[model samples]
Target: MEGPRASGGRAMTGRSGKGHRDENFPVASKLLRPEHRAPIMAFYRFARVADDIADAADLSPSEKLHKLGELRRGLDGDGAPEAVALARTMAERGIDPIHAHELLDAFTQDVTVRRYADWDSLIGYCRLSAMPVGRFVLDVHGEDRATWPLSDALCAALQVINHLQDCAKDYRALDRIYIPADMLAASGAEAEDLALTAATPALRDAIVATAARTRTLLEVSAPFAGGIRDRRLAAEVAIIQRLAESLTARLLTRDPLSERVHHRTVEAVLLAGGAALGQLFARRRR
Candidate 1:
């Protein structure tokens, strides 16, 4: 809740005080090489700043758009400190700013777009919002472009999982809904239902249905880690895949509106360990 404020005393960055450790999946964990971690963290901070701006409750749409534009400009050489840091890292690493640009575009869309019409529409948004992140990471590792398909799937699944996990809070606090309107209609649920303290049967059905679709994405990305050439990055991917699978399963059976769906710290650590081992063995088999 505590963040920078504008002259009017409105919060400028809607930072939830969440860092990489607070994410649903690991970010630039110790598994990564030191060189890779710095640039990745820089990219993450840029993203965090942009996301906070877009989600800032106190900022009007115009103000949010303007702030996002500043970040976009930063990519070009002048902007916010976070954006400048990311640009410096990208320049030093020879990583393209295309992904960062795409992410800014997505955040800009968040300023005005409130609902998705269908699954395809939602996936379209993910293409802008989620896929770029994986692509950016792969670029950081200097991994081949061939790895992007699975990465895209995994990233999108993770984004949707986060959406499902925070559905209630997002709806109640921001009045922004990411679940497809059609999906809600099919389940006899309305967007307003998400505001409830507990999910209704119909709302649960919609959330479960979304989880099922996200499960398919997880399936597609199941081999993501195996496709990566970087051992450390591959291991990280495996951990993320495992986490996504577990969360998707939880979404199917748990109520996001009232339940604790995210993994506890110990659970996440164990899952990461097991996934790392599994990836190691699988790679050795080849």
Candidate 2:
């Protein structure tokens, strides 16, 4: 999230200047064809708008819900430019609006839900918040619907990686903690540990436990890229998988509250390069 932006000349809940680049993974990156990229960016902006509303520190829960409703109406036909744009793209591409509506459901939950009770509950949230984004992209590419289960695994892993990386900031800034209560309790840690300057031993244990679980999700998604029939989209998924793997490994060892968990630009480029070449080679052999 960043500074607010004006929506069509009027103030729309703090617009958080957060762009695709600020995201943990690629968004409409160059890996996909230009036609594919356009609709993806539209969907991303619509999502960003809803996310900004849900995350606005200044807004009350009621206000957030109201604004989210307006965004939803926009998705239906007319609302905000962002929502209208996404709706138009969906219509043009013959894509269903269910995925976008599912995302709105997650954002609506974000307005009211602050803590996750267990791993099952956390994954349930990801089913709404993360899984649809991948499905939407796959739809835009006209990929087989059969590929969704693997895509769901990869997207859920990415979502958890983000939760782990932003744990402390989310706790302090929003009072929202995604680290499941059961995991925290099992490690003798409490939510307050996130407020400290660094992670306590218990907090570290809980985080590592979450990271380990995320790794399992990644393993289940290992066949995802190979399963995709679209070469470009397959390559993009491969790059994202590598990035998720690197970040998950960092979370396992480094304290995100005290240490940098994200990759530096040079390192990310190298990892993406390697993954792209490997994906290309694997496709050639196939």
Best by lDDT: 2
lDDT tens digits by residue: candidate 2, 1-286: 1111112111345477778887768888888999999998998899988888888777788998999999899998978788988999999999999999999999899878989999999999999899999999999999999989989988988888888888987887778888999999999998999999899999999999999999999999989999988898888899999998999999999999999998999999999999989999999997
Candidate 1 residue-wise lDDT at 227 = 87
User: How accurate locally is residue 148 in candidate 1, as Cα lDDT from 0 to 100?
Assistant: 87
Pick the TM-score winner: 2
TM-score (C-alpha, index-matched) for candidate 1: 0.94
Q: What would the per-residue lDDT of candidate 1 be over residues 1-286, giving only the tens digit for each residue?
A: 0011111112445564657766678888889999998988888888888788888878788988998999988998898889998999999999989999998888888778888999999999889888988898899899999988998899889888888988887777677788999989999998888878899999999999999999999999998899899999999999999988999999999998889998999999899899999999998999
Model 2 TM-score (2 dp): 0.95
